[model samples]
Target: MSDRLVIENLQVSYGSGAQRVEAVAPMSLAVPAGQKLGIVGESGSGKSTLLKAVLGLIRPPGVVRADGIWLDGTDLRSLSRREFRARCGSEIAMIFQDPVNALNPAFSIRDQFRRSFRLHQPDLPRSRYTETMLRALASVSIDARDKLGRYPFEFSQGQLQRIMIALACSSPRLKVLLADEPTSSLDVTTQAQVLDLLHALQAELGFSLIIVTHNLPVVAELCDRALVMCRGEVVEDTDVISLFEQPTHDYTRHLLASMASLPRIASGAAS
Candidate 1:
């Protein structure tokens, strides 16, 4: 099957010369048009670095190299920053773990929603933009009227996360969502609710997702395949069920064991 996103022999390093820290080493993976692939690892495992390299959001002083990162056969690394932004901003959207930090504190929910709308359809009339924003909020079960004028700080964490989801959904060309621990800061119940919302939206929108999280159970419940990262390399990649039933890598098994040893608190409890 053809991939919507492919990373080949990717390497990322932070710092210069002897002081440098290698974050990724010869990593490769692919996400087909509408598949959910989870990258699981503890902190410092390079999972987030991999995602940033794909997004071309790596800042100066950090070095990134890859044989190629192809998006539907186009080499993304070959494009100039402006060219890539023109294509990527609409075709790909990301949701961070903390929606509060991702959103603007001064802007109303309506203002943030407009940012997405402008990216996809800047020429849309005032009434049409408002209509699209309301529909996007409604799709996530948010009360469009009550929350539209409120700023990010005025809403609960779960509500803010859903609004971010709505912002992602507002863009018609969004074909992939790069989610980095989207529910890490939420309460257990809220986490499950947000995850379910993400699953529903992915299925409904026909968009692929690459979720980076250390939570094994969440990966089991949400993703079809898993990529296990240790240090700076991908040690294991397999279907989610197969991996849980019979893991190949020692590191993968260790991760599962760690998750198993956690308190048997129910989902949605503060972790």
Candidate 2:
């Protein structure tokens, strides 16, 4: 399959001169079309930073340098800010680490969706905004009637995460879904639900999924290929089975050992 997303010679850094910190070392990788790829690492390993660079969310005093960042066949680096925004809106989406932070405490759910619709679909009829959002909510089993007038704080974390997922994948044009620590804050059962939802969405939507997480089991279950990173560098990039059974790097082994329990995955993520 062709690559849906491509990164070549990418690096992210903070500060400058003697104080400069390389959050992500120069590296390249690709997310295969209609496949799920996992990036696993400990905290400070630059896993999340890499995702930020890809999403164009990094700002000064942070810097992003890349030879090419292509979505479909377009190099995102060549686009202007407005162009980049439009392309990302239609071709890519990101699920942040925390839904609590992603959602607003002050805005009604309707208002939240309203803002998003205005940004991505400005010409969309205002009357259909809620209708569109409601349909997305239904996809995640959220049965809302009348309208989404409730606040984010009113929902459980799990529900909030589902809502966020619904929001992220709402774009029918989405080609790549980039998720960062999606289940990090959820409890075990909630985590399972979120993972399952992502899997189902992938099957239905047929988009390439790139998940950035520290959890080995999450990667094993959901991803076909895994890339291990440490201190801003790609340590190992291989199929998930090889990543677990025969990690080529000491850091990968140490990470496996550090986990409280080794992954129980026999093969792939649970259906």
Q: What is the lDDT of every predicted structure here?
A: 0.84, 0.86
What value of lDDT does candidate 2 attain over all alpha carbons? 0.86
What is the per-residue lDDT of model 1 for residues 141-234, given as tens digits with 9 covering 90 to 100?
8867766888988889999999888887677877788999988888877887888888888888988899998688778777899999988888
TM-scores, one per candidate: 0.93, 0.93
Which ten-residue region of model 2 has the weakest summed lDDT?
260-269
**Residue pairs of candidate 1 with colliding backbone atoms:** 188-268, 188-269, 189-268
- lDDT tens per residue, model 2, 49-109: 9988988999899999999999997999999988888767567988887999899889988
List candidate 2 segments past 4 Å from native. Answer: 260-269
